[model samples]
Target: MPDTTRARIQQEAARLFVKSGYHGVSMREVAEAVGVTKPALYHHYADKEALFLAMLEGTLAGLSRLVQAANSQVGIRLQLDTLVYELLASAPEQRVGLQLASELRHVSPERRAAFEQEYRRVWVGGLSRLFEDAAARGELRGDLPPAMLARAFLAITYPLVTGAPTSDPQGTARALLAVFLDGATPRQGAA
Candidate 1:
């Protein structure tokens, strides 16, 4: 189903939620923002948390596809570069939707757990496969665990993925890859 109203609700709600945090945005505000009556909005979503979860789940599922496609490239380095570039290339609203996962603090514990399962299954699991392969091949340095390595990559680059204007995504991808694929320490041959 095209379901434009539902999609619009998610889009508008995302913009509102991004501008104002989970607690900051309310159902009435979301309804107003979406130009839908409270009854209409409630028809689509049970309540605020459900709407929030739907938005988050939808974004994460799309991102999971992007990550999988990026991972199709020959090597992990190329994949990482593509992944960061793809994310940076995504619309601000979409990036904000991805970042909204961090706002799980306000939702019920059950809701939080549900989102966590989807996040881990869709978002983190998409990236974890690369590290798992790399580790199996003994390509990853040190004692890095596959899942931890994936999480570390997210920890390092996500701020840029959602924050301030990025003048150069390729350059940004390169810098992030440098720190993640390489390290902050000086090269062995550096002066």
Candidate 2:
């Protein structure tokens, strides 16, 4: 049989996890929300923590794909502008996993470690590559670290959970790009 049940489980479970903190929801509730028996949910995920980890992994993978697409752009400015706009334009529910950023403590150390590794490798590493490539081309300041620049770039997007999805992603993209690039660009006659 197909694993459509797994997909259904993830959708319902993500809603539940986003609605309630990691500790606030239970396996039974997830099963109930998905209209499946506890056994069916368990067959897909070992436990609540496992389900949460899966959600986090999916979120990272989605973001990694976004960054990968942005890399095809010729310039760091275009790559970052496009990435930010795409993220801001995304459905709020699509970011539900990351929106639960504060609840990661409820997850076990081992699982958290694994997710952190993947997060750094795919998400942060992907953004860092954009800056790294730009720095190699002398398009950005070599005096600063690309990872630091990448983190600064990402910090702007963290507040996304509180606001409505952008009605004008392009204008927002332009405004955001101007702010970021203004700081990131090198100074010609600095003492």
Candidate 3:
């Protein structure tokens, strides 16, 4: 199997897996979509599970890089803003990975566990460190646990990526961050 063929297969398979659920797609269909023969696809990935895992790994790797780059900067507000904008910009690609993660339980228990562990190590672990750094810097509210705050932030802002009608994801992200950083209610101290 040539490296280019394998890469092509992985790219196309990831796209299809996002469009259709894991169970909804078949190896033969992937091969056809990639314009490769079934045997050629098999030569690269012995089975659908192998292909799926490769796609998951690639997605996780991309996400890990995105988070790490954002965390490398010091300011909590800047970090959060960078993360929000990147996530919103990459929503379509990320949505596929999120859908796969949500549906991972349908995979065999052993593989599912492995997938989950990798997800935690890459996504959750990095997030935990970033939030903890923010707290240690006294940039975040002391009353909130960094991990809890990180999850809440993600929950609150992710919808903008999926639901917002605007063309500017970055602008939408900045506004969403304002809501999270500030509050829905008017400040009592305001004149």
Off by over 4 Å in 2: 183-191
Could you give candidate 2's per-residue lDDT for residues 1-191 as a string of tens digits? 25787778888887887888788899999999888899988888888888888877778877887798799888988888778877876647446867665578888899888888888999899999899999999889998899999898888776653467777878887778878888556678865
Candidate No. with top TM-score = 2
Query: For each candidate, what is the lDDT?
Result: 0.83, 0.81, 0.79
TM-scores for every predicted model: 0.86, 0.90, 0.88
Which parts of model 1 are misplaced by more than 4 Å? Answer: 186-191
Taking all chains together, the TM-score of candidate 1 against the true structure is: 0.86
> What is the descending TM-score order?
2, 3, 1
Tens-place lDDT per residue, model 1, 15-125, is: 888888889998999889878899989998999999989988888877887788777887788888888888887847556776687787888999898888987887788
Top lDDT hit: 1
Please, what are the lDDT tens digits per residue for candidate 3 over residues 33-147? 8999999898888899888887778779978987987887768777878888888788877766766666676677998889889877887777777888877888777788877
Q: What order do candidates take by lDDT, descending?
A: 1, 2, 3
Per-residue lDDT, model 2, residue 57, is: 78
Off by over 4 Å in 3: none
